[model samples]
Target: MRTLSGDLIAHRLSQAPAGALSKRLYDVLQTAIQQGAIATGSRLPASRDLAQELCVSRNTVLAAYEQLQSEGYLQTRTGSGTYVCEQLPETAPQASLSPSTSSAPFNHIRLSRRGTRVLARSGAGAYQWGAFMPGVPDVSHMPHDIWRKIQLRLSRRMPVEALSYSNHGGCLQLQQALAEYLRVSRSLNCAPEQILITAGTHQALDLVAKMLCDPGEGAWIEEPGYWGFRNVLAVNGVELLPTPVDDEGMLLPDLASFSQLQRPPVLICVTPSHQYPLGSVMSLQRRQQLLALAKSAGSWVIEDDYDGEFRFGESPVPALQGLSADAPVIYLGTFSKTLYPGLRLSYMVMPKPLAARMKMAHSELYRGGNGLAQLTLAEFIREGHYAAHVRRMRQLYSRRRAALVKVISDSLGPAFLSQQGNAGLHLILSLPERIDDVALAAELEQKGVLTRPLSAYYIQGTQRRGLLLGYACVEEQNMAETFAPVLHCLQRRLSPA
Candidate 1:
C-alpha cells in the first residue's frame, strides 16, 4: 500500500540501457502504465519533482510527459498532476493483446485442421447439473463425513514424501489399491506397476492416443460413442473410423470387410461395460471377437469402464481387458462417475511391456502430483468405503431411474420409447421418427429439463433420434417435479400443428 514516489520511479527508469532521455522516459512510463505498475487514475509525480529527482532538465521531463499524453498513456489536468489513462487510446498498438500482424486482426490467425474439426464437433454444454443432465453423479449422496475424516487425518499425519511429486505412474499405495479393486470387481488383470494414474479418463485416452498411435494413424471409435473420446482422438490427429454399435456393443466388421479399409486401425476405443449414452453391455462373444480382431491386426483396445459399477439389476459385466491373458487391451477407469468429478482421478491398466514406456511418457508429459488425494482414495478403497458407496448409489440410482421411467411413461406414453438398460447412470429415450431430438432437447432445457441429443453422438450414417436422460443426480421424490417441464415440452412439440 506504499505510494510510488518521483525519486523511486526516476531511479528505476535510469536502469534502462543508454538511450535518448526523453524517449527512454516515455517508454518507461508507457510500459508502467500498460503493465499496471502505474495504476489507472493514479496521479504521477509533477514534472518538476521528477526532473529534480532524476537530475534531468525540466524541459526534458515535460517533453516525455507530452509524448506520453499524445500516445494516450497518460492524461494531463491543468493545475494538477498527469494520471495514468483508464483505457488505451484507439491508435495505441495492440501488440500485447494480439499476435504480431501488419494488416490483419487476431481472428485472421488460422486454426490447425484438427482444431477446426474439434470446434465444429464441440458438444460441451454450459450447464452440468439439472434434471436429466447426462453423466453427472449425485454428489449430494457422497460420504462427505467419511471422506473428510480420511482427508483430515491424512493431511495432519502424511509423511513429507507424500506431499511431493509421486512416481511416474502414481502413488504406489493407490496403484496397488486400484489394481486389486479392478482385479476383484472388474476382473482386470493388472499389477500395480501396470497402472498409470491420470487426471481423468480424458487424459488417459490422450496418453493412449499419443503413445500407441501416431498422427493420421487409423483408429476405430464407436459411431454413437463418448464425444470426449472422439474429440481427444481427433485432436491427436487420428483418422477416426466410426464403427457402428449394435445391440451387443461396437460391431466389428468381418475380416473380409476390414481388408477394404485403406489402413487398418492401430487402436480401437470401446466403452464395453456400459456403452456410453446408449447403455448396451458388450456381450462376452463380441468382447472375445474384438480382442481377437485387435490381436490379429496388432492393434490396441482401450476399454473405458466409466460407470460399470452402477449396474441396477443385471450382474456386472467384467471388463474386456480381463478376457484374455495377453489381450492388447488398455483398461481405463475413472472415479469421476463413481465418486465425484472434481476429484479428477482416473487410471489406465497398461500391458506390462508398454507400462515402462507409458510411465516414462506420462511422467514427461504430465508430471504426477496430487499424492495426498491419491493416498486418501487408496485408503478409501482398501477400507471398503468405495465399494459400500457404489452399492448404495446403485440402489439410489435404480430407484431414481425407475421414477424417471415411470414419469416418462405416465406423461409422454408410448410415443417415447425408453431403451431398457439396467446399467450405467443414463437411459436413452427414443423419440418418434418425426420429432427432432435436438429441437426437443433445446425446448426441454429451456423448461428446466436437461437432456442430450442422441444424434449428436453419431459421427456419420443414420443417427438415432433420441434423448439421453440421466437419472443419477435426480432424487426419487423430485423426479415428478423435475420431469414436469419435460412432459409439457413434449406435449407442446408432439401436438398437431
Candidate 2:
C-alpha cells in the first residue's frame, strides 16, 4: 500500500515543467497514478500536511486534489482522506515513444476536391503595401483621428446587441447611409433593406455563390478579370466561362451561343465601371447589351463597383443595377479600395426579389458582428466626411497617376502605356510579346517595385503581356525615383542578350 506522501509529491512537483503551482502538483499526482508509482486505491497525504511539507498553500493542494479527483486520477473517500482511483481515466498506460518515432515526419494530409481547386489558384501577393501594389489604397491618408472619435462616441453608448452575434443583414444605420449614398452618387436604385453587409468582397462573393449558384451551374466571368471571382466560383464547383473583354468591357455572348452550351451560364460577373487590370469602362451600349443578355438568359449580373469613386476625367458611370427597375443585378462594392483594407467592410445590394432570402441565408451562414465599425462608418457618411474623403483621395490619386504615367513614358515610351483609363488607382504598362511578364514582375519585386502581371488575370484566350502599376499608394514626389528600379529591370529584360 504505497502512499503519495508530501516528500515524493514535492520531488515530482520540482521535476514537473514550470507552470502554476496547482497545475504542477496536479500533473505530478496524475502522472504518479498513471504510472502506478502510487498503487491503486492508495491514500494521499492530507492537504494541510502536504502544503506544510511542500511550502505551498493548503488551497493549492486542495485545488490539485479536486482536479485529480474530477479527472478520475484521485478519489476522495470522505473522512478517509484522498485515495487513488482503481480505474484510471485512460484505458491503459501511454506507451513510451522512441526518439526516431517521435521525430518521424508527419503523414501527408489529403485535401478535398474543392480544397485542391482552391490551392491551384493563388491571387494574394506576399506583400500588401508599398509602391505599385494593385487594388490597395493609401491608408496613411485615412482620417484615423476622425474614425477614432466616432468609435469612442459609439463605445460610450455601446448597446448589448452590438456585442451579440448579429443575424439581420447588418447595422441598420450603415445600410441606410449606404442606400442614400449609392442613390445619389452611383444612381443605384436600392432600399436599405436590400443591402447585406459582409466581411469584404470575398465573403460577399462566397455568400452569393452559395445562395444563388450550385455545384454544376455555369458562371460567366470576364477574361482578364478579378482572380478572386474565379476562386470563389471554383471552390463551389461551378463551371467558369471566361468571356473575353475589349475596350468596352465584358463582351456579351450572343443568345445563340448560350443555347449551344451544355450548361447555360446562370451568373455573369463584370467590372463595368472600370475593368480590373485593363481599366476600360464598359461602354453604355455594352452595358445595355449585357443587361439585355442577362434578362434573356435569366442570369444574375454581379456589378463589382470597385474604384468607381476615383475617376479622374469624366463623371462616374451609373451602376448596372439601376439600368432597370427589376434588373437581375447584384451590386457589389467595398470600402477596402476607398478607405483601408483592414476595415474588412463590403456590401451587396441584392435584387428586390432575392433580398429577404439572401439576408436570411447570410444570417444562417455568417453571423454578423462589427456593429461599432459599421455605426462609425454610417456617421462618417452621414456627416459628409465620406464624400469629402473620396474627393480628396481622387485628387491625390490623380496626381500620383499622372506622375507615374509620365515616368513610364519618359523612361520606356508612350506605346508602353495600355488603356490608361480616366478612373481607378492603377494603369497597365504593356510589355513586348517576347518579355515574360511573370518573370519580369518577379525581378521587379526583388528590386522593391511591386506590380501584378497583367497576364496572370487571364483565365482563357490570348494572354496579354503587361504589368498593373498601382500608383495610388505611391507619393507623387517619390514616383520618379520609385519607378527607376522598375524601368532599369524592364530595360534589362527587353535588351538583347
Candidate 3:
C-alpha cells in the first residue's frame, strides 16, 4: 500500500486549477484512490497536517475527509487515522459475484421482445415547438397566472394523502368537473365515477389495451392514423388492422381481409369527432355502423375526441359516446391539444360496466398522483376560465389556420391542399403519390420547417403522401415568412417530378 503523505497530497492538489479548495482536494483524492495511486487500505494524513501543507483551512480538510468517508471511499478508525476502504462501493458487488454473474457488455445486452417493439415503433420527435409542428397548442396564451395562483394556493396546504399514489381513480374534483364539461361541450354522457384520469391519450390507450385485449389480439385502427395509438397497441402485442378512411372517417375493414385473425377485433380506435391528421368527422351513419359492429363483435370502441373543441364555424360535433344511453364506447379526451401539451392530463369515460375495473387497474398500474394540478384544473373549469380560454383559442386558431392555407395556396396551387376541414389545429398538404414524403419532410426540417409525413402513420396499406402542417402555435402575421422556405422547396420538387 502506498503512503499518501501530506506533501504528496498537496502536490496532487496543486496540479488542478484553483476553485473551491475543499472540492478540489476531494476530487484529487478521489481520483488518486480510484486510480490506485493511493492503494486500497492506505492510511491518509491527519486532517490538520494536510490542511497546513495544502494551505487550506482545517475545516476544509475535515469536510473533504467527511464527504469521502460518507461516500465509502475512506473510513476513520477510533484511535488511528483515515484509511482507504478495502473495497469500493462500486466494485464490491462485482468482486463478490462469480464471473457468470457479471453484467453483459452494452453490445451484448438485449431488450425484451416488448421493449424492442416499443422502441422500434416510437413516434416522438426531437423538437416539439416551431414552424408547422403538428398536434401542439399555443401554450403562450394559457391562463398561466390563474393556474399558478391555484397551484400555489393548493400546494401550501396540500394534504399528506394528496402526495401518495392516487388509488381512488383520480382527484374527485377534476373528475366531477370533466363530467360536467364533457356533458355540456361534447355531448358526452358520463358520471364522475365513470371517468378515470390518465397521463395522456397514450396511457389511456395503454390501459384500454391491457384491460380489453390479450396479447396477439386483433385491433382495428384508421389508416394514416395517429401513430401514437398504433405504437401503444403494437408494444402490447396487439395485431394492428389498418382500416381505410374516407371523407367520412374510419371505414369497416372487409371481413375477408381479416381471415388470419381467429376472432373479431378487440378494440377499434377512432378519432371520431375530428379525425386526426385528416380532420374528417365520422358521419352519423358511420358512427352507428361502428357501434353496431363493436356491439356484435364484443369489441370496445375508443373514441379519441382530441381537439374537438377547436371547430372553426360549426358547433363542435357530438362525441360518439353520447349516441346511446349504454353505448359500448370508451370516450378519450385530452387537454394536451386544447389547454397545453405539458399539462399531461387526459381522461377516459369508460362504459358503465368497464369503469370500475378500468379505474382500479389504472391506479394499480400507473399509481396516478398529480393532486395539486388536478385540483388547479378543476378550479379553472369550475370558474369558467377553461371555456373562455377555449373560445378565445378557437378564434385565434381560426385566423392562423386561414393564414397558413392562404400562403400555401398562393405559393403552391390549391391542388396541394387536402383534408381542409373547418376544424382542428392542422391541415394536410397532399403530395403526389410518387414523391417521397418522408424525404420531403426531412428536407423541410433541414430548412428549419418541422412537419410529419402522412405516410409514416400507416401500419400496412395504401399510404397517403402528405405533410401535416400545424398553425395553432404560430401567429398569423408571421405565418407567411415562416412557411416561405417550405413553399420554395415544394416549388422545385413539384416542378420537374
The sequence of per-residue lDDT tens digits that candidate 1 reaches over residues 1-497 is 22365754675576655678887777667666665667888898888878877788999889988988877788888888788888877666532221121336457678888889988988888798877899999988889899889989998888776787665588888989998998999888889999999999899889888988889898888888888889999899888889888779999977767667667799998988888878888898898888878887888998888998988877888889898889999998899998999999999898899998898888889888898899899999999999999999889999998888888888777546545678788888887777788888988887777899888888785468888988988889998998777777767778899
Q: In candidate 2, residue 60 scores what lDDT?
A: 97
Tell me each candidate's TM-score: 0.80, 0.81, 0.80
Encode model 3's per-residue lDDT on 1-497: one tens digit a residue: 22346766777776655678888888778777776778899888888777777777999999989988988999999899899999977852211222332447558778998888878878888889878999889889998998898888888998877788887688888999999999999898899999999999899999988888899899889887888888889888899988889889998744454444568888898998889878899999989888887776778889998889999978779999999888889988999988888989999998778888998999889999988889899989998999999999999999999999898888777988866789998899999887788888999998888998888887785467888899987899999999888778777887874
Candidate 2 TM-score over all chains jointly: 0.81
lDDT of 3 at 488: 80
User: Residue-wise lDDT of candidate 2 within 1-497, one digit each (tens)?
Assistant: 22346667777676666678887787677766676777788888888888888889999999999987776788887789888888787664453332433466888889998898787887888899989898889999999999899999989998887778777789988999999999999999999999999999989989889988888898888898898999988898788988888899988767677556666678999999999868888998888888888887788999999788988877778888898988999999999998999999999999878988998888898898899998999999999999999999999999999998889888888999966787898888999999899998998888888999988998774478998889988998999988888888888888889
Task: Kindly report which residue stretches of model 2 are placed more than 4 angstroms away from their true locations once superposed.
Answer: 1-105, 256-262
Order the candidate numbers by lDDT, best to worst. Answer: 2, 3, 1
Please tell me which predicted candidate would have the highest TM-score against the true structure.
Answer: 2
Q: Which segments of model 1 are wrong by more than 4 Å?
A: 1-109, 256-262
lDDT of 3 at 465: 89
Q: List the pairs of residues colliding in candidate 3.
A: none
